[model samples]
Target: MNLFDRLLLFILSVVALVLGVAVVLVGAAVPIGWAQMELTRHPYNIVTMVVGGVTALIAIRFLFFRRRRDPKLDSVMVAGDHGPIRIAYDTIVQLANRRGSQLKGVASFETVVRQGQGGLVLTLHMRVLPDIDVAALAKEAQNAVKSYLEETTHVPVERVLVQVTELGDNNRSMRVWSGTGA
Candidate 1:
């Protein structure tokens, strides 16, 4: 959650907790004159009932609610003759996927693009062939993805992170025959 959202929730929770405690105290006959007087009068009853109901609702909602995070990536601005062109986030991801697919050792991959301070950061989760050199392949994939994305989208790539999640066995036999699998 953001700072402002957390702060608002904190304030609301504190208010609700205090009001709830007061209501409970009055209900239990704690002998607080103001609460007793407020509870006894008809007009004050309406006010308390409304406030108590609202507070209960807010408390239940905030406590039980799960906030979903936004999955959309930030839009990129491009210079156009008439005006600025806004590029959708999915387009960048698509470009990254295409670039990553062209890498020889990759069996499958997923791409995530996000806006960073420097510019865009692209993270690739890739499963590759077990026979390849992981370090060299990762470096090459990073460079290729970075260069292709920047060149194709004209968006500056802050970083291209290639995480090798799995190394498949498809090319192991070929590498073994070629004496390079080890």
Candidate 2:
């Protein structure tokens, strides 16, 4: 997917292949050890070594040179030491922001989170482009929020309440964020 993921996969492939070859070699060595034989007697040893080197080289290329990359988000929603849910409120806010930003016509949005007026309610102050489908966007965001938070954090998100805060023209607001730049 992403650069990090591709590299990880490459490293794992190399390791697994090496381990597999090693096992075969060790298995062959046991019988030879009993019979007092040498590696030169086994013609397949050369082929095995060559294949192992080629496999390692290919893995290295995938790990270092491939261009297409995806974002590797390992951590999403882990719970807190002392909270109603293991997941912190900030975590929910982050999921809301990510979901809102992913929507097609969202301009920008700010999160104003508060303790649930009902039960574990999340509210988003989303600014959107004027021409967007408001209802469909809300539905999409809600679904994404629910799916991501549940899978990553292992927490049940009861409600994602969204409010259309404003229609953004996109000049000044785009340059600023609720907090410092990443």
Candidate 3:
């Protein structure tokens, strides 16, 4: 929910809490003149019931049907004379993954594309061989993926982030030697 909706809910909750407390105090016969007068009046009771019912409905709406504001790009459009060419976000992700996988040292990788102010931002998380140079590999992957996406799909790539999450055992080796060097 947005800030306004959240603030509204907060205000409603406070008002409901205060009304409930007032009803309890009146029921206990606190002898407050104004409270007793308001509780005894027929119109006041109807107004309170209506306000409470509206507040309940608002709370229910917020709880069940709140809209999310996540950055999910379903498609990208390219301007053209004939018509706009639309490319699916999943297709872009697949292309980026394929380009990144060309790097021999990468064990596994995942690609995520998000819509940004300038254009689209591609993020890559890769598991690579332990012995490989991480800095060089990340840079190469970033450039390659950015170029491929922008060139193929005509989508402006704002940035490409490559995070090396794990180093795999691709370069590891096991050997055993006799104690006496036999």
Cα-based TM-score, every candidate: 0.68, 0.43, 0.63
Count of steric clashes across candidates, in order: 0, 4, 0
Candidate 3 lDDT by residue in tens digits, 90-173? 899999999998776777778998888999988999988766778998999999999998899889999998899997665443
The list of candidate 3 runs beyond 4 A from truth reads 1-54, 68-73, 169-182
TM-score of 1: 0.68
C-alpha lDDT of residue 53 in model 3: 61
**Local accuracy of candidate 2 as per-residue lDDT tens digits, 123-167:** 777777766678887788777766776676666557778888888
Name model 2 segments beyond 4 Å from true: 1-86, 113-119, 170-182
Highest TM-score scorer? 1
State how far residue 47 of model 2 sits from its true place (Å): 99
In candidate 3 the C-alpha lDDT for residue 48 amounts to 54
lDDT of 1 by residue, 1-182 (tens): 88799878877877786786576445554446766676676445546556666676677677566667554435788777899877877898888888887777777778988888998888999888766787887898899889987788788899888889987657555422222454
